[model samples]
Target: MLQDARSVASRSSQEAEIAGPASPEFIDFDRLLAAVRRQWRLVAVLGLIGLLLGIAYVMTAVPRYTASSNLLIDQGSNRIVDELSTSGGSIEDESGILSQVELLKSDQIGNKVIDALHLTSDESFMHSSVSLLRRVKLAVVSVVDISSWFRAPEEEADDEAEKRLTALALLGNDLDVARVGRSYVLSISYTSPDPVMAARVAQAFANAYLADQLDSKYEATRRASSWLQQRIDELRQKSLETDLAVQRFRAEKGLIAADGRLVSDQQLTELNSQLTLAQADVATARAKMDRIQSLLESGDTNSVVNDALASTVINELRTKYLDAAKRQAEISNRLGNDHAQAVRLRAEMENYKQLMFSELGRIAESYRSDLQVAQAREAAVQRSVADATSVSAGANETQVQLRELEREAETYRNLYQTFLQRYQEAVQQQSFPITEARVITDAQVPTAPSKPRKPLVLAISLFIGLAAGSALGAFREFRDRFFRTGDQVREELGLAYLGSVPHVKDKALAIPTQKAGTGTEASDRYLRANNAVARYVLDHPLSSFAETLRSAKIAADLAISHQKKIIGVISVLPSEGKSMISANLAELIASHGSSAILIDGDIRNPGLTRAVARHATAGLLEAVMDERPLKDCILVDPETKLALVPAVVKHRVPHTADLLSSVNMTTLLDEASNAFDYVVLDLPPLGPVVDVRAIAPRIDAFIFVVEWGKTARRVVRSTLAANPQIAEKTLGVILNKVDTEKMKLYRDFGSDEYYTSRYSSYYHQGK
Candidate 1:
């Protein structure tokens, strides 16, 4: 029979393990939502803290006003000179506009503004709020003399230099330069504690920038003019010397040519021109002659060749040939091929055509004659040019030297003239230089501060706080190693989750069944509340808690069949409500019309004994020691009619474990098993002592009780590991003190309509 109960308990444990709550290893959105919902107070508190911080910042922060001055940079061309044109077209390139922005922020303009405004002496400008910390640090450095450890530090700068550097730094920090989109416009903004000062500085920056541009242009022009002036004087002197040298050499050697050109120079020029014309004439005549000759050979008549046939004899021959051909055509049209008149006309026309051929040959000969004359003229001009070149070569070496000197003189003269022209332009530009950039919009007095954007800061703070709070909540949830759900027990510890017992509010109602009519009003109220909770199986049998208890009962029945009814209830830690489970389980078995005995096996803390038999002097210990009869130690509850063996001893037992494993105790359990259909022992917490281990072998199976969301996994695992025999006897773990309302937060856990109680109001509709 005991073997059968063990088999049933083992089978029940396995089934419970399989049918536990869903594990968190899978996606569980409901669990995450529940976690956030449960920790909302923390989120709200953190958000409030962030909001307060934002408010403090707004209250304590200094208001800074930003005044912007927009300047339109006409980058198309330099106003001073078109020679200094830029590649900037209608639209400015990214780099071009960015460079303009950089120019606006440059130190040159910064220094100019500083000097113009005399800001170097302004305390706020020299030591703005932005560098207050730095100023304090400098003050400290000036006072401290910690040069003993290291080499002596360098001496500080004079007040003027320090003030200048501080102003520069402050100016840089206060200035903001940005391009206005893709346009050739720049926005120069200045920030200051004083609104009017900000506006003044911004406007001054634009003015200073424009003035700097004009000054630079004028300076460049002045420098150019100075260089040109010096260069022009040098060039003029050099030109005069070259001219004098040329004239002296020409006079000394008489190598100067009239009209600034030698006879050979004129001859070469005239020869080259005539040679070109002669060559062109020869080519034209040759081409015409070739055309006439080709026409004569092919027997083709053309007007161009008629020029070669300009002879009177040829003209008469051509006219006679045409008259003869006309008469032949007239006769051929009037008579047949065999007619006498047509034959005579044909003979006459043939004779005339032969004469015309002779005349054409004469014209071709004339064209050849003209081509020869052109070639002769070309050769004559060539000879004249050669003679002229030879005559010029006979001139002395001084002539070449004179030419070189003249060329040098002319070159210097041109350079001097060019420099003189540029110098005049430069002087004119220096007098009035134009700036490329202009102020599109002047800086206006700022009406408000740009810093301390309250709403934006508050919004950012809220987001950060929310993120931090959520992270903290998640961290806490992750750090917790307890069994938050029955699935944790099943998945992590590989233990079966028998069932969960909802947290009972009224402990008095959870008391073991006592004698009827002996209960007071307080006890009745406690009983009612308990009936709705821990004792739900008796009063609210159809409730979720009751259903959970019945499930556990079913599992116990499976693990321990009718033949083996001796079961032990234990937990890993105290306050797990194992005693209550044991007592209730006993009552459940008794209500099934089976005799069930409940025993308090925990001698150290006799919870069951205190609840069932408060005034009893002797119980398990005395019965085990044979100091009292076993029947005298057993108490029968009148309400449940279940037999109870409470551990109500007057004095503590030194060797409680030894007493529990004694032969008398074993015999007592054996007799109780025989007398009752079911025996339940409320054992000590498994984690706190080894008493449970000693009794583990005596009991058929154990109902391992654990407080839901409270029992640490490490404690349960370590306790079970330390006592392998007890672990083996454990039928399954019972999760006590479950928050059912909280469980509904996880959609998957309590989505069932039955658990939600769709008709919950039906029970109290008439009550």
Candidate 2:
């Protein structure tokens, strides 16, 4: 009992948290269990469907084949090799090889590969990877230029190479090329329907690069050979003259085998290039240097503009005007020349553009006009350089003119020195020319194609199908909650199951009339639905059903040995299950040989006529309204073990609950209770005209009927709550028509109860 109470409380608390205050009270646990039980079939079907779909997907999906090849990249010059150069070649190169990876992936090399592979004639190779993300960095600008192949179908040639190109263009989309680690190797992988083709394509790319590199080296050698030949002739004359001039100078200065300026010719060339760039940069950085130095020296908090005649604002405005003019001209081209709007825009654009260029020239000239300032900046730098110690010649420009001949001779002398070293290396290079880059391994034609995985597709398809089925099953459950489970009667209306009868299998439906032509044995099968429901209530009396009242009375009777309780029946809504409750309970209870009285309390709308007939000319309405004796109003039956009191209303002035709850009605019930084992009150449903509330407090127990999905929860709650006496003493709720297809869905155990219903029996037997 404690456990049951705890479970109920916990469940109610959970419901409150989930559904807030609007949640309907909990129904009978057995009914919910039954509903879930009934839906087990749907769950099974949907689950099976999901499983089958998954299996089907596993079967039909295409398998993708993969082919991979590698390329080793010699990323940068050997750093250690350069350090070990005791031969005195050049300074140590400090830059790492990682930065050189980007340079290798630059457009020049990529274009070379593209041209060599003839990708310009095949567009498919350009989109080597998906947009936004790639397996390797793209050398092209965001998009691969595949315009050559896709130019036009008409442009495609009829040759076999062109045909292969077409197919290659299509298939190349599956191929991916990227540089291998830091070595001089590259990895090319491709997925295709045919594995051999994938491998062949990858190998083709490698061969193409090798061929391109050889061609490039040969061209460089040719250019170098031509350049060296020209220098050889030019230096012949300069070499002889330099020797003569040196000898003459030597005689005049009385000097012997002296040092020459040719010692740093290479260094002088590098310094000259650097100086030229520095001069151009110096022009721009002077104003900046002055501003920065002034701030550093003066420690100023605010900036001071130095040039009063500065034309930056004007120059900037002019630049914008030029851009706008260009845009206007471009737009004008898209239109006609003689168009008035176009002509006006073009004129305005040209005028602005000219103004901008003129303004920039004017600005440059203004700066040049300040020659004194430029000279002053140059002089400061010159002073700084003068203080710096010199290691090379040509440090100052003032030492010139007569030194040109000397410079020429020195250049020739440096060339001779380089030739002497090259001559020595060339001898060794020929003897010990090692080939480290010979092919380590050759690629082979792959035996598989890597693509079209149908299994993955089928798997996804299966998931979609099962998900669709499961969703549909869930929706099917929401249509009806009444006949769905036994708990419905108890939880929804605070009623109880009387008792449930097993559904008879394949029983012939035969409605024996009042004449009893078929006998009682055959009739039992016809009325199995009503009997089964009554039996169900004996076990589970979750709510206020009269069965709950019966169970309570029966339990209370356990101590007393034999005590019966009188139960009053009512429903919040009219025509829900009040009539069924009276007839079925009376019939089922009497089947056990217990005497039961069915008092039809609805005087205005008597229900006994449709269910059973009793002798009654003047009934309870006349007795209650006119104060007739209790014995005369009630009728006793010996054959069925039941009694009936028909209302004499005949749709006349109704005898209300106020009349029934009077001392007269109470005295009548008291007498009947002593005479019968059980007394059933068929009370009026709650509505505007019925006085059900007035007589509620007078009942020993009451049964409320909620016709499954038909009765509104709000109507029942409101109407019941309005009658506190009835709500408190309510026996429980009974869900009627719970066997309707809608309600039967909640009946986990499939039964043929419908086939043997009284109506079914009556209809089938007649047919």
lDDT of every predicted structure (CA atoms)? 0.73, 0.52
Q: Name the regions of candidate 1 deviating beyond 4 angstroms.
A: 1-28, 48-63, 71-111, 120-173, 181-185, 207-440, 448-451, 494-496, 506-546, 626-628, 648-659, 714-729, 749-754, 758-767
Candidate 1: clashing residue pairs, number: 4
Model 1 lDDT tens row, 608-636: 76655665656787788865677777766
> After superposition, which runs of candidate 2 have C-alpha atoms over 4 Å from their true positions?
1-40, 47-509, 512-565, 571-578, 588-595, 602-608, 614-638, 646-677, 684-691, 704-723, 732-767
lDDT of 1: 0.73
Assess candidate 1 and give its TM-score to the true structure.
0.58
Per-residue lDDT of candidate 2, residues 621-666 (tens digit): 7666677866566554333545677675566664465677688787
TM-scores across all candidates? Answer: 0.58, 0.40
Indicate the worst ten consecutive residues by lDDT in candidate 2: 524-533
What's model 2's lDDT at 38?
60
